[model samples]
Target: MGVVADRVVSILLANGVMGMRLWFGQVRWVYRQRRVWVLPAVIVLGAVALSWLVPYLDRRWAEELTRLPTGEFAGTFDASVMATVLSAVASGTIAFSGFVFSVVLLVIQFGTGTLSARMAPRLTQDWVVGAALGTFMATFVYTLLVSLRLGARVEDYQPVLSSLLAIGLALASVALFFTLLTRVINFLRLVKVLESVSRAGARRAAEVHPYPLGSQGDTDVDLGPPDRVVRHAGRAGVLLGFDEEVIAELAARAGCVVVAVPAIGDFVLPGAPLFEIHGGTSLAERRLRRHVVFGIERVVDADPAFALRVMVDIAIKALSPAVNDPTTAVQALDHIGALLLNLSGRELGITHIRDRAGAVRLIHRCSDWTDYLSLGVDEIRYYGRDSIQVIRRLRALYLDLLRSCPSERLAPVRDRIAAVDDDSAAFSTAFDRAVATSPDWQGLGGPAPIDDRQC
Candidate 1:
């Protein structure tokens, strides 16, 4: 009986810990994604609270407000006129809000079609869009509430402060509308989209792989065959990320090394092997699973490879026969190259996380330099093989990377250059092959090396 009771207590404790970790993980995801609802929700609630507080304050300080210069201007509107103006503001702003939503949907549709579908989330979660919608909604809510407050009021009982605030909000909404429009226009540009994705990739790469190449010592730790393998029991989804600290702490407590079976961003299914617990007392499977977050789609916040994945998707899509836009492919490579350059200096590959006693507690796979190079170069090279612009740009990219990447990382870059040469050799004519093989940073119209031209 006592043993059963202890088991029940242990299960309850594990569940409680898992619940807290999941909650914190969700909060982090929301923050990283910058969900659109957060700002608007705050703005709408503030409007509701201010709508009540401002009217009361206005009534109390009505006489003193009239003495102020700005308040004198605010007092020009009688109660009926104030109500009319608020009514107009309320109706106009709500209409504006609807229009903004319509425009957002259209923009998202166009962007998803033109850019990679992975970009849809970035478009939808844009803070500018959120700010514009929030401002418009706040204006509508504030004006409507203040207008309701003017009901059955005497002519002298004008909410001067509230009236002024409503007008200010309306004006602010108009300004934000223009700002949002400009942002949308800029976002629609291909270059801007590439730049945005590249920047996001660079940021995530720096975050995930903070140590420079060769900075960390060997991460290998030998633990014999696992005594127990934990299989996932949840619905299938992409492994968004895991909390190394939490997992490491749990492993340390259990006197074990936990080996993660699937890398971040890998699609995991129910019954898939999730962890290999070697040399430790068994851990609660629920506890292990809770520290790892899963989502229907992978996000860049935790997966450094995702950004490269997105760029490669864009590049290959542009290179498709229907599109046959080699220039776009080159542009995509430009950013891909930039991201790789940033990553070239970073330490990558399987990481071994340790606990306070310096014992290896967790093992997880990470994208290595070779994986990134392949992801960034392989597909574009194949699809763009027939396009001279793409060939030349790829040659230049390889040369640039070879010149800049670390000595230890040079083999992959050299191999890519050789691959480009081999692909160029497949051209029908010598002149075509030479130009294709020539490294031109501009993809064309730039001076090629004399030796390259001769070749």
Candidate 2:
């Protein structure tokens, strides 16, 4: 009976730990999505705590400072004068914070309308905007508290330390305000935005596909039709990601192969099939569901394709009739090509998780090369078909990929090149068709090889 009780306690403890982990993961996912307010809230709280501590320290230090020779240099101000200064600082900072909020709103408006609406979330989540707002608010709170403390005292007890610290924070707020303006201006630029998205996409691609293509040997594990299916039991949400190690461990213990039905970034409704368990003892549905994370919207942290999707959105938006900005479309393709180049050398497709005994325990789908290639190129080709500059840039991008990508990847590149030719054929004039079909690395007015002008 003691042994059974001990085993039961251990299982309970394991479940407790897993529960905590799942709860923490959900909180983190929500925080990342809605983190704009978190930093400012934390900073304001810190200021409130500091308001009490700084006055306490100031009282202690004031007593000691009077005994020092340099006490006169500490810039003592009367209580009334210090109160006025603190009030002024408080009023100015609150006004500054309002201005900062206005600027951020304008940035969001301009960025979404002029650039792509996808960038709205990114703009809102920017740390610069959050930090600037937090600093301004912290300064206001600290000064207001200090002033209130001074007013409540009958004796003229000047908080020299608190006054100096408030001034320092005010100065820091000014500096950050300027920095925020600079960042807002940079965000409005098209090239800067493209570079930012491309860099993020490259980082995610590196994380998702760390190894060179074909570096790991592919093993054929035929796990036929599933013996049982595990369906989602929670509210409907987008599948953000899953803990592979945990799922693999669960599958290994059950002596089964688990295949994920929905890929990361897929929206799974309640009662949808989440996993298919093949040839194993029955596992708890709660255990399987806990390991998979869900969120309101897909994020780039797990979805490598999201970056490409954003850049493509920017490109096609530029190519729209109202925008009619083929140059901007070409620039978007520049970054898209860079992201593709980064992915070209990496491993992609179905991922297999193995147990200690080398048995395939978990199988999950990943975006492969062709998916990425089509995503990065097809929309721009279709939208900008008549624009000579866009077509030339597309031709250049395809030819560049043909030369750089591995032999196994060449077929897709050729197919895209053929598609570009078909697009070019729609040009109204022969001269326009010829120029559009030819590759120009600069998109236009760049040297083309004399012998390579077959089109």
Candidate 3:
């Protein structure tokens, strides 16, 4: 009974408004592209449409509208009062919202100087900020129409209730206006932004790969030569995410394993191999691309690497000569290490997709521990070689990772440590080299004896 009830609830939820929002391609595009005006425009349009209905609704509920206590709730809202409030809401909302929006954009622009401009999409697409704008617009439109209902004659359809509602809504808009500024301040802090991105990646990683790390994997799935290649058109953007369930269904219908070529954050080029369809007899590239979504820039859609990418951005910026902040680089390493640790225990790839009858229909291989570690480590080490703070922190990070990860994952870390040692030899003074070369977690100037021992 419980299982059946659960299934019923799941079906209901899937058909709900939120479910429709999640599944719609165009809605997802608005979110990914950060079309800041789209949602608010819809709100404004809806408010205008609703305004037209207010008179009819008020007439239908004339008894309820007239009997409602207007004492203190409407505060002597005459035609002048109504006009004053509506005008303030309409004009003040536009002016204040414009100022806040400009400030936020400026903050994002300044942030791009330190972080990557690629991150700008994130702030622009924020739902809270967008909704704030929408709320102001909605309030303005509603109040304007309600104000029009106020008349000089006592019985000329005053719309007392609608006017009061409008005034209350205007007050609410003022509150939302202040909240938008708060959001702007919080969004300005780069560390906060990076942390949010990392957490988003973690949440997505958890959802997509439910199995624990080093867990059982598909035993025998043929991920051999592809029967056909699905190339992308000339549109370039960050691959945000795809509807995995929908893709699985399409693949099931076609009887093939469609493996995505580039990871989520990769800049997909024109004529690039987007998918390799194994055992696909007559799959159209257009049909397959429909399941994928590419935005203006990378977002934490499903890829775990995006978090690491942001961390690397911070670390690289810190290592740069313009902003010599090794401490910030070290800070990034901590979060990167945590994200890796999260992945270390979870399964990495989708090796097989099965139907209801447990028939294997798809095979894919996502990048494993080695690729992610290299992304987090390689360039920073190359760029920050001269900084003792960076090299030492990396040495400690690797030493800790070496002890924690499975034996096979140790090779890349070990190799990188050796490379760091060589870099230290070529670049470092004797004292700093001694400090960096030490095998311990913090580069304590001791022998790195773990290389000989079991990983």
Best by TM-score: 2
Which lDDT values do the candidates have, in the order given? Answer: 0.81, 0.81, 0.68
TM-score of each: 0.86, 0.88, 0.81
Which scores higher on TM-score, 1 or 2? Answer: 2
With a 3 Å backbone cut-off (N, CA, C), the pairs that clash in candidate 1 are none
With a 3 Å backbone cut-off (N, CA, C), the pairs that clash in candidate 3 are 213-345, 213-346
Clashing pairs in 2: none
- TM-score for predicted model 2 compared with the true structure: 0.88
